[model samples]
Target: MSEYIKVAVDAMGGDYAPQEPVKGVVEALREKPELYVYLVGQEDVLKKELDKYTYPEERLEVVHASEIIETGEPPVHAIQKKKDSSLVKALRMVRSKEASAFVSCGSTGAVLVGGQVLVGKSKGVERAPLAPLIPTATGVSLLIDCGANVDARSSHLVQFARMGSIYMEYVMGVKNPKVGLVNIGAEEEKGNALVKETYPLLKECKDINFIGNVEARDIPKGVCDVVVCEAFVGNVILKLYEGVGATLISKVKAGMMSTLRSKIGALLVKPALKETLKSFDASEYGGAPLLGLKGLVVKAHGSSKANEIKNSLIQCITFSKEDICGKIQENMKQDNKGDN
Candidate 1:
């Protein structure tokens, strides 16, 4: 048998819990022969869910986790207390190098806290960032610091740009990905103090292709491959992006079904429209990755279904194969040496 990429999955972390997670794991194992999974969750629940699918038994194993961390609980307290929870166990697997990555649809706070505290950060990494790929008109653009480090400094934004660049270029197959600082205007003097400070630093960086300020409106037009911002601004952009996309899709469907003539037109356009809509679905791109960590940690949507979970697991394969953490570590080391 070929070498396998083992992934530790938090089977009880999402809204669908063991059912969707189990189904997704089984689907991934069936689809990728060289994959191994440690499905961490309540054993009985996982086993019952596993009974519904047919997958290679050798490739999938059940690891027991007795507790669960709820979304409402404080992250630091939960991570310290829920040592036997599925999320924590999966993180431990990555930390110990037993698994190439950890995937969760659990509490965002707990995932972020546990990832940094347990899995630790790569050497010379200042702050870990949650970066997710957002759908754009031309393709997907990577949004870095989407939910981590809300009070990030200028240096952190620079690192986010560089790391986002590496991810887009290597993992997403975009060559010489253009990096842009999120701002209100096209001119360099337009954004707030943070952007003002970070802009010149990004321009000075020789490693990444730094583009000028990118307005929020221009993001959907694929003006840049990597979008860099502090978490506060990035989160607002992401949520607004999602809300607008959903509203537009809903309005389009409603308009199509409003009248008899439109219904006929909808029938003719449904296939192509569905394909286009599917490409824009955030779930199609998997989960946000907490980059600059010692091990890979993917935070899937809490409402993730079988398809999103499967994509999340599959994305880990590319991340591990490309040795993203190693590359990030080397890059950070180089940056630290330059500073010294």
Candidate 2:
């Protein structure tokens, strides 16, 4: 392929716009000499931002795009209409095999829609899932279908489990990662029709380590490496996880500053507490990937800053190096052979 793991970044995407995305690219270039980033956006704006940072000029190139895809626009229409937009231009690079992956903090809907239309799906993948790693008590777990495929089928959930397993195993360095279907109870018949059907399918698959049902309550306790569900359920769990983590962190800080005794205590434990809390930060894990596509397409937070963007770009290195898309396709081929 390319000499470097070229990442076509949507410089105009995200709440922070050209500034944060530009800074993140410069920051990423400083960290990795192997990474070649094509910052796709308005040339003049990107150039101005680049001037503020000192990084290797050769590694960071800019592709001029005339337009920007606003978050509020309808995804399908935007992708079709905004051909010269930053988001579409960056995706086209991936489609053309000029870039290894595409990273965007822009419209999630646009990314999801364009990724499938532009990058296309693997041979046997029916539906792509948005898989994001969420922090847990012990570590982090992959929450598949977080925002894509809300009405996913049993077979789709089964594939999600398998993809999630591969991602956890190879990229995250977890071996035979445990896969759990999100359910109300541990019983086989606890969930709706889809989960019940998928439960048996997952159990029959010898490829993944199928770890029965995982209750929502136990999710934060590091219940499993991969949690599988329809997009609706998965999204709820993810939102709740984010909300609770944020609330708890706020409450903890407020409590520490409430009174003289706690204030004194906060100072003594500040270093250790900060270290612990930082581990749970979602940004530390990078962006959520839309798996099952032919090429890697990651969707960073809409409000992403430099660190998040940098991490998202950095995350693609592992995906490309490990050949995650290839592995998923191979696994599906092997599974299909067994079925036949």
Using lDDT as the measure, the top candidate is: 2
TM-score of each: 0.96, 0.96
lDDT of 2 by residue, 148-192 (tens): 558888889888999999999999999999999999999998888
Clash pairs for candidate 2: none
Residue-by-residue lDDT tens digits, candidate 1, 165-218: 888978898999999999999999898999999898888888889988999899
The residue pairs that clash in candidate 1, if any, are: none
Question: How high a TM-score does candidate 2 get?
Answer: 0.96
State in Å the error of residue 220, model 2.
1.2
- TM-score of candidate 1 relative to the true fold: 0.96
lDDT of each: 0.90, 0.91
Q: What stretches of model 1 exceed 4 Å from their correct place?
A: 336-340
The C-alpha stretches of model 2 lying farther than 4 A from their native spots are 336-340
